[model samples]
Target: MQSTEQLDEIWQDRAIESIINFVRSADGDFNCIEKLANAVSDPDSLQKIVEFLSSTSQGKQAFQKRPLLGNIDLQKLHRLPTNSLGYSFANHLLTNNLQPLQRKSVENDYEFFAAHITETHDLWHIVTGCDTNILGEIQLEAFYVAQLYASRFWLALITKNLLKTVIYDIELSTTYMDAIAKGWVMAKQAKPLFGIEWNLLWETPLEDVRNSLNIILPSS
Candidate 1:
């Protein structure tokens, strides 16, 4: 049997290989968004996005935007209004949701991006007004799978939804595709309007931030 240390080394090697493959496969020519848009069903807006990314500098800009979590203030985040969407989402995870993978040890920039995206997932949920219930999560995942070029997001959604169907009595298979379609519509609308600066958002009080950013909250 492999020792724990040896197993960890092997796992780390595999993880590195997977990330390298993902980066090479998706963005090898640095045209991942276009590739993703083409592979999925062609929606006009998505096609427009592809054209925009392909023609303009935004795709490169997005890819170039270095991860911004290095200086986040966890304490300030905790002090935000309890009812604020970000705070509420964080609370839900702390109190009821399962623990996500630890992020501190991630060394590669690409791996860091993947982990960053996973951590901010609830922010997207809040932005989309999707709850964290089984149905809602699957729906949100489908939308994310549709929008993001990361293959892991799509795979995670598929595997998790399939497992939910088998083990949790959730019936998501038939509706997931439709939910993704709807989410794409909403995301297109929302993405253009989402303009919060990372540092300002982290420090600003939720209500003030929401008002300033024009984020609409669902009625409680």
Candidate 2:
């Protein structure tokens, strides 16, 4: 029979391999973010997310209502005024060939968070001017960390990408660092965006929505 130590080492090796593979192929892949979150999920982080989602009236309602937006018709959004948030979001998805993420249920805080974030990830990119690229993705994760400091998933997600860039893609280190810095500062300056009723704001002008949300973009 294999020794317990040997079994432990084997498990560790598998875990490390999985992480490496994930980091290597994570670029522009939403699944990687979801996978990383799942891998590092803990009860502490879930509680922190719940608290973060409950601190504001909108967030409180979000937590209670668990609003799902993935089922909305893209054509309706597409027909909105070009300056509308819905139009921008729909265009972003259609141009990129991305589909809204479906959420079946929210049995827990983490599930609610994951589903909501997934559905709104592209919307965030549109609002924040983050491109659908590796740097933008990392920057977004850093923004999440700034807002949800207690979330191990966000922290781990940021750490892995930073390490990957530092060790394997040193040429990207400076730009990635800049992205992280920008995201952190932007989050600090902006009002909380979690648990927002985006459906209500879909018809609002994109800039109007951002202004109401007190979003401050990083300077060029």
Candidate 3:
């Protein structure tokens, strides 16, 4: 078996290659959302995604934030309190007896989005009441894929669901997918009808805030 160091190195290399390929595919464009959508339909369109991501305001912010974590210890991440978003996510995974994939080192603007998505995944779990189980992850992935149009992520979800169905006899992945679709629709409508900022959702309780905004939670 490969040592942890070796595995980390391998993952880092693969992640770097993926980022480079994504960037090169972009040619020289800076419209990531459109490029990403197009890339989903056409693999070669990733070049535009890379270019767009490399130039975005969010991408620049992520680039600056990454170095801050370099000096800090990652293993200490596990020691954070359960109420912390990352800790909650980790706890949820432990509660469900699921293991997370090892961290992969990434570079460049494409990597920025990767990091953002990875870190924010736990926040999604908290917001959506999704657990860390395979079924829950599949559902959350569909929601994110719909919102973000990240092709590779969507593919990963599809592969994971297929494996789960074959190995565990799961039949409810479609239900999870439907939930994501509905959630997306609700979010889109709620933003306009409720007239609340997205960031405020974190500060306020969903039910109470929804009431204030006249937004109704979909039936459980």
Candidate 4:
């Protein structure tokens, strides 16, 4: 077995290289994303988040079952009732040609926490109405930063992207900041999504799910 220090170093090294590559291309990098998540994911944060999840009845069951969201059938979701969260999410994925996230190897409770967050990431985007565009990504990251406070990777990305935008177009930089502000505010008002069993809510009306979760979508 690898020592914890060795694993941390591996993630950190991979994360730095991946971030650099991602910045150069502006394309999504799954491996890099996972590495970044694991790099900053400390044991304390994991335990606290897990404990929060365990506080709820659904959360306790979620930890025990460890349902993988990626296993959800998009075809079935596409056939769900109109205006259903799952239907909308399925449509979003199909329209964007985005695939479900693959499960990452989880060696411990901390790693499981990071993996769970990564797996449910797109579901958060759907409920929040954030697009898959670059600006949308920054906004969503801002939201995550507000809700989860431990992502140095997001902060770095936000800073670098903001600088890039400022140099490319002053007006666009303003727009990006607006998106970030909205994300922060929306996250502040939203219910914690940490342990939500999204599979159970697929049939729920999209509006109802948003209302229940206190989710405020961004203005188009």
Tell me which of candidates 1 and 2 scores higher on lDDT.
Answer: 2
Worst 10 residues of 2 by lDDT: 11-20
- Candidate 1 vs candidate 3, lDDT winner: 1
Clashing pairs in 4: none
Candidate 3 structure quality by residue, lDDT tens digits, 1-220: 9998897677556644544344444322335323433334333334444444446454444455542122222234346654443455456556656454333566754554455455454555655665555555555565555444335545544444554455555576567566666555544443222111233233344445445534434556
Candidate 1: C-alpha RMSD after superposition: 11.8
* CA lDDT of every candidate: 0.49, 0.77, 0.47, 0.75
Instruction: Output the TM-score of candidate 3.
Output: 0.45
Better of 3 and 4 by lDDT: 4
Candidate numbers sorted by lDDT from highest down: 2, 4, 1, 3
TM-score: the better of candidates 1 and 3:
1
Candidate 3 at residue 122, lDDT? 53
lDDT of 4 by residue, 1-220 (tens): 9998998788678756755654554446666555555555556565766776677776677677676665778899999998998998888888889787757466665556667777788888888888778788888888877776555656766765776665555778877898899888999999877668788899999999999989988677
TM-score of each: 0.50, 0.85, 0.45, 0.77
Model 1, poorest ten-residue lDDT window? 188-197
Best by TM-score: 2
State the displacement of the C-alpha of residue 53, model 2, in Å, after optimal TM-score superposition. 2.7
Stretches of candidate 3 exceeding 4 Å from the true structure: 1-60, 63-106, 159-174, 186-218
Question: Which structure is stronger by TM-score: 1 or 2?
Answer: 2
* Per-residue lDDT of model 2, residues 24-114, tens digit only: 8746466775666555665656787778758888888888888877467888899999999999998988998978867877796667888
Model 1 lDDT at residue 166? 57
